[model samples]
Target: MKSFAEIRRIAIARKGEHELAARMPGPPERPLRDLSDDRVLAEFSRRIFQTGLSWKVVDGKWPGFEAAFHRFDIARNAMMSDDDLDAHLRDTGIVRHGAKILSVRDNAIFLGDLARAHGSAARFLADWPATDAMGLYDLLGRCGARLGGMTGPYALRVLGYDGPLLSKSVVAALNMAGALDGAATSKAARVRAQEAFNTWHEESGVPYAVISRTLALAVPD
Candidate 1:
């Protein structure tokens, strides 16, 4: 694998120092532990609905979603009645996809279950070690509805969860770096990939997100 220094140098040459600094993300303004559960669920729902659709349309209708879903209060959504769901299916305020709408209630319950098991959903997400991002991703896939693929990671990222998302560029860079033999399609491959990111984190003193973006920037699209 190329040293992270080498990768950083390539990214710097590609984008230049000033532009890269401006474009690269930093630590979120609020720590993950301080975030409200409602906000976490809200972002999750937003990403869930945004999948395979125009993000612009989703953002424009987010207020309507907020109103329809009671601002994504976990307890409230966990208790959303069948009638409430039926009403939302017909409501023009938000996307009318039945499955995605159902996921809102289901994931709310998932969060409530987390709260019961670990004090609160926020605490559970905030406390998961960032180095084991793959584990966290698996946990969400098992426990939360509609959180498979990048949905869970993307939502967690919005709430300050620092981890690398396996975007196409990132996966390509990982392959080029010899992190794994190919796409991280198997459990062992993903775990190996996570270890690679962990090693870079220790070596560079940069968060996984930073390393991830650096890798993406270093490689050709």
Candidate 2:
């Protein structure tokens, strides 16, 4: 097995030769003024979560989700009446996967309670320690939230989050750090790649975030 430094050096050498594209426009730098509005945040999260899914599948149906779930009002979602939810299942516009939809509702309610207990959802999320790729995958798997995998997490990283969101840029940083094997094939290999890259950045005094962004710039569209 290669030492972490060796992996980083290999990754840097294999950094996709194509010129990087412009950064995709990400969320705003500052939180919205009414950041506490759960409904809006839920909407944003929903939209983001739906990215890889067909928009046609989620667009017209979103209103149904909005209406059926009390506009995703955290308080209301927590207090959702079973009868109301049953009625919502009958709606034609929404995705009919009961479990998945319910998961969203449950997550909303859970997040709401967490916020109330922790003072703010942002703060609560921020308190969670940053993790490498494998750690993030495990966390998401344990949470039972749908649609999150390596690619999904990478997208989340690009989308930005209250907590560290790993991105391709981070992957690049990992590569720079000697964390990745240029020949990596599986998800586990990719994760090892990230660890190597991060270790390199930490020891080299290179700002990981800057390295990530710079590496992101090297990725082709």
Candidate 3:
């Protein structure tokens, strides 16, 4: 794998320092350990709903979603009644896709289990090693509802877990760097991708999230 410095240099050259600095994923606004479980579920729901959809439209209706979901209180959602679901389908406040709506309850139940084991889902997420991003990805896919593909990773970053996102451009840059081949849609490819990012992070002490964005920026539009 190429050093993060080389990749970042390429990104800076392509995007310029000003834009790069402006756009890079920075440290979490609040410490991850302190993040509320409700907010964590909210992010998961947001990413799930946003997949293959217009993010702008989701953002616009987020208030309604928040209200409908009671700000994503974990216990409340984990116990969603069929009647509540039927009501959500009839409500115009949020996207009413049955499966996606069901994911909210499922993920909440998942989080509730995490809290039972870890005391809080926040601690479990905040304490996970970012170097093991692939492990995290695998765990979410195995356990969390509808968190396969890019959904879990996107939600993780938004939840303040600093890790690489296998976005299209980032995947292209990984292939270019010989760290990955074809799409990183399989488990082995994801492991290879994580190994590459771990090497870059160890070599340069840069956060995986920034490295991911840098790699994407390295690729021209």
Tens-digit lDDT track of model 3 for 64-158: 99999999999999999999999999989999899999999999999899999999998898899988978988889999989988899899988
Return whichever of 1 and 2 wins on lDDT. 1
Score residue 123 of candidate 1 by CA lDDT: 80
- For candidate 1, write residues 67-145 as lDDT tens digits: 9999999999999898998999999999999999989999999988888998878888988998899999999998899
Judge candidate 3 at residue 94 and give its lDDT.
97
Off by over 4 Å in 1: none
| Candidate number with the higher lDDT (2 or 3) | 3
TM-scores of all predicted structures? 0.97, 0.60, 0.96
Top lDDT: which candidate number? 3
Clashes of each: 0, 8, 0
Q: Rank the candidates by TM-score, best first.
A: 1, 3, 2
Off by over 4 Å in 3: none
Model 2 spans with C-alpha error above 4 angstroms:
1-21, 24-29, 32-34, 37-52, 127-140, 147-159, 162-178, 181-194, 197-221
